[model samples]
Target chain A: MSPAPTRRWWAAALAVTLVGLVAGAGVALSGRALLVVTTTRLPVALAVGGLALGAAVLGVGALRARRAAALAVALAGAEDAGRADERARHRRFLARLDHELKNPVTAIRAAAAGLPPGDDPAAVRAHATLDAQAGRLAHLVADLRKLAELETQPIEQEDVDVAQVVRDAVDDVCAQAAAGGRPAPAVRITLPTVPWPLPHVRGDVDLLYLAVVNLVGNAVKFSPPGTPVEVRGSDEDGAVVVEVADSGPGIPDDEVGVVFDELARGRDARGTPGSGLGLALVRVVAERHGGRATLRSRVGHGTVVRLLLPAGAAR
Target chain B: MRDPAHVLLVDDEQAILDGLAPFLERSGLRVSTAGDGAQALTAHAAQPADILVCDVLMPRLDGRSLVRRLRADGDWTPVVLLTQVGESYERSAALEEGADDYLNKPFDPQELLARVRAVLRRAVPGQPSLAAASTLVSGDLQVDRAARRVLLAGVPVALTPRASLLLDYLMTHPGELLTRERLLSALWGFESMVTTRAVDHRIAEIRRALGDDPAAPRFVETVPHAGYRFCGPVTRGVPTSGPRT
Candidate 1:
């Protein structure tokens, strides 16, 4: 029923037919010999039968060679198609990068042009606008660099304390607030106080720290002041887990799935400032540590983000 | 009313410092400026400001290191960080480093002023301390830690020692996602033979006492494979008479 076996059967049948024709000629010559015909006819019939047998074998060999050539062509075509797909993906990435960079650059240029040639408050405001736009552009570049590094760099795995990482991330956010001259949001870290020691996870400390910092920082950005942002750590399902919860406006139900996409921001985060690489980086860091990053949020209530990493050997 | 708080603003960029300095000054805060982290430290030493407003990334030192160094030295001056990279990771890192708050770059100046006031209000002297608070209230649920009792809508809810401890912990740390394993380790010592299932059972018991449905949990929401979170707009309440366990 299959095409390949059917073709083979047809080739075998053709060879049989050629053999049959030669045999028929031989039979006819034998009959003539018996009926007093000359011995020359018998020799001619035997020579024809030998030629036919050789031709049938050659035809079968040719059929097999053709099938092998077609198979090789098909395999080559599939490989070529895979390469094309990869190239297309690369092109798409480059195009997205170009588009992301252009927006901020254009804004910066416009702000620069608006700067007046005078010592006035308006000029100062214009300069500030330019500075902010330039900063935005710079941040985009930094995020891209981090993404590239995450993709290409080899992870240095070691025993890392999830609690310590959480503490350091909180510290980083506080420092940013102090440096920026903004009031730091109240961040509450809930660690087991009675337990003398905290559980450790296996991961690159620096990358994990960055990932946690991103989660907490996002909570602060979306939440209102006076409401506390909570960071907590615990062991769950044989893994060391850290969670950041905020009393901020949460992501919509529909948009929750896409928040992990590179450069994806929530629909409610339209006016908020971000490059949208934070969650993406968290996912990358978690996966690299043989873990995962997950989020749950209810609109207007709050959002909770968790980073779960494999538990390391006890120290 | 107390005098307007003195705020020291630190940033690497002259333009940012220049722009933000006048804005704070206009908002009626005594503002000082520093170029980098080292300079911010020196400036803080000479005459300490009520609050520090610093940029996260700078040439001589970063914001996190500066705050850490200050905190390590036992300086408790309230600190805030100004971040261009407004990721949650950076914000949490700042907080861990001893920053009181942070605002993303390109923020409204008025918003920054409001945050400064809010932090100062919380830092005011003789405030009710979270650690010392004996009664914790979230919605209609109340837990009296010292008395070891829980009340839902003014009705007494009997709980086991472990369940009471769990409830107290949850009430004290509202809005925190506490994992079942954490509950197990904390309530029962790290070496306790109890499984995570025990924690689940205890939670179920506590929820039943509070009349919270597991399917649509109001007090303790299950986080699937992760753990549980006490959803709360928690408030501290004055201790009241309750039957002790």
Candidate 2:
């Protein structure tokens, strides 16, 4: 029931009141001068009855409205409180898990180093594999905790040059690939400069750098030897958009939806050496900076990932 | 800070101490262990270490506070902080709080050793650390990286973004001959030594912007079909607090 009576109720009450008035008048007409005083008294009685009925209807509606409104507010408040508690618990749990894993990871690495030197080829492979796996595990744990921390952590606000970030990330990726004895993919950069130059992004520099590095690094990872990766930066309606495209095998259609989920790995990424949290971290950092990470792929053609941020949004 | 440097390693995790202490000692250095920051303080008071490689987020006291305490007491010992988080604000804050350098955890032990050695070697009584230097100065030319603007003879000079980055790369590796192939891979992300024309173009642009004649190079020197190098002297310093242009 609402706080106010419906129009139908008001209409019915008006009809009832009018009928009572007419009935009272009819009684007066039917009666003689000797009953005039009784007729007037009877009309007053009908009006008083009408007022009492209207008051009763309004009183019930007001009570029900109060109760319903209070219930809604309580439920909403409880839900918010529950969500906050859950997030806090999740963060603390991840931190503790990271802390606990670091010790064992370090110990495993040490134990791997102390593996006895031997002439068996299998033994040598085991030694290197153990050490590498331990290190990878350590990185995975750190990244898991970092993603959670980035969710609620306060980030810095600085004038960031995306071009500079892209240049640096590309440089680092190429250098790393060369060091690993793999053919580094050639990267072509296209950025807007004619239209008053590309506007500086108001964001955290390190976070932005992380996004570009992940984007370029992933592109390089899946690209074939001697293929070129393209990075295009442009201004869109006062917002900045960076697109990194690669000539690698595009992700399968069925596996595309979950690639950005935390610790998600696509079928095509089976043999890739990654922590499987790069895209997730990039998305989180994008959200934290009032932007978004998007992807489009054609399975056989390639994949294009875009990171868009609105200008002047330094939040 | 001394030969056969003494390293004080502090952490709440015994496994780290157990694993790293022996490795470090095997590398020919003295090591002392502390369970927490308080114990570290007592140990430091008893016998000062030449270098302190400690983890942040320790019990009893934390790494940043320990650094502050040491700095307050006029102890300028080189300190390297290790942490599990990679927050940018916290990274800058750690350096500003007087830490010589900080490394994120899950790092290679070899890398940690390299950092320790590098920090120790560069710990000149009052010079700024590597990460803290936001500006690079070469005779009559100043590049404020934080500001992303360059100055020549105290006057701001306008250069394209690519040229500016090239200048920065050259300035950072001053006097080191950077071949065209190397520059292309480092600056252009090229895989092979494929036609190094792009490198020569950018170098020419930067040279023109800086008013340097190829015959008599003041900033960038050509190596006659080999490569290029920034022959100017370079120094690291803190940037003036702003964008001056």
Candidate 3:
């Protein structure tokens, strides 16, 4: 069906014709002697043998070429599809950004309208209102920026202090936990006591931090107040694995893959407020780190998200 | 206590400061405002403030960063954050950074006031944890926080963590109008933007576990807009008809 295969078919046809001519010429040139020494079956046999051999060699070459071309086309199509998906994801991200931005703008407007301010009840209420709305907007922008950085850049691999990163992440979210009005979810951080001083792996620490933040935050977010969110790290099959597990409603077995799509909230998470980009962002960051994220969950149990980063590209 | 709670409010917008400054002051609290986190930090350090009320979004310093920077310097002040409709992601970041509480935009002034006061109370030396342990008792239903167990008519009822916590909070405040904010803060923390319907969904799960009829309404009474109430006459201790005692 392909052009290369068709060309090969054409070549085979030409070869067959050439062999037929040569065989005919031989028969004619030896006409009298050939007739005397050979029966009619001899000429026919010679012609058939020559043609079949020519066809077989060309056909094999055509088949191989066809297979290779098919593979190339498939890969091309996949890349195209991925590009389209990326574009679509970007659009969704922008839409989310718009929605997130609107609130603060609305608040700022309201706050300003009531200003020039002293200690009026109206002014005080406005101040608090503006503070809260602006806060929401800042978070949205930060997440958006993270997405952009990941898309436009590549991580530089270097010796990263895994233990230090973990400590910083915990410290980062500790205050957030307290501010959210729930007792800080107990964080059980378990890592090798020894500073493994893992091989320098190429990665962007900031991006990885964002990924860590998202995972830890989600663990705390989904869990009930006072529940523990655990962060565990270990070496698995030569890769450094980090896992964040929560004692909240786990993803359904069937929806595990669906949870990593941009703006794709889980079935049970429908009405809950989520960026929907959390898992998607995590997935991207994991892959960028030369690793991937896998989720294991039981319906009534809990969800554990594991990020596997290759230990400094195998020596 | 704590100098009657001096509050430092930070936001890029002046209108909000204009409106909320007076309301907070009238509520027996002194208020200060900064247009951004940098200014806030400066104002906060000029004179020690009891609390930091901050916006997550700003020109230079964001709420999460403000908290992060503050914590980096070993400065711990209670923070209450404000979020928008889809900014649940920020809620976690804000909390992770050490913010004390968060309220969504278009929030009722009274609700905001309540949240601020609640955060302040918890931040105060002697006040109980914002999510202080409390038991809810309704007819045939008893939720014990200390034991993390529930009973229906003297019978122990099995509940998922979320369900047990939800029922426990409801049962503890029998007659009080438990606002959604309070419930979310008590259960998932203010970082979670749990929908009212989700609350109903969990309540349904609770009722199913209790083997109670929603139409007839035995234990948890659904109070539209205001939150749930424990209407069932409950007695604490021992299982009578719920799960295996």
User: Best candidate, DockQ-wise?
Assistant: 2
Chain A only: TM-score per candidate: 0.61, 0.70, 0.66
- lDDT values, one for every candidate: 0.70, 0.75, 0.66
Runs in model 3 with CA error above 4 Å? A1-13, A25-69, A88-138, A153-158, A171-186, A190-200, A225-228, A236-238, A253-255, A270-274, A313-315, B1-245
Q: List the lowest-lDDT window of 10 residues for candidate 3 chain B.
A: B189-198
Instruction: Work out candidate 1's RMSD over C-alphas.
Output: 19.9
How do the residues A149-200 of candidate 2 rate in per-residue lDDT, one tens digit apiece?
Answer: 7788777676788888778778878888887898867999888779566677
Output the lDDT of residue A75, model 3.
86
So what's the TM-score on candidate 2? 0.59
Worst 10 residues of 2 chain A by lDDT: A1-10
Quote the RMSD, in angstroms, for model 2: 10.0
Error of 1 at A263 (Å): 2.2
lDDT of 2 at B4: 84
Could you tell me how far off, in angstroms, the CA of residue A183 lies in candidate 2 after the best superposition?
Answer: 7.7
Name the candidate, 1 or 3, with the larger DockQ value: 3
Quick one: ranking by lDDT, best first?
A: 2, 1, 3
Model 3: docking quality category: incorrect
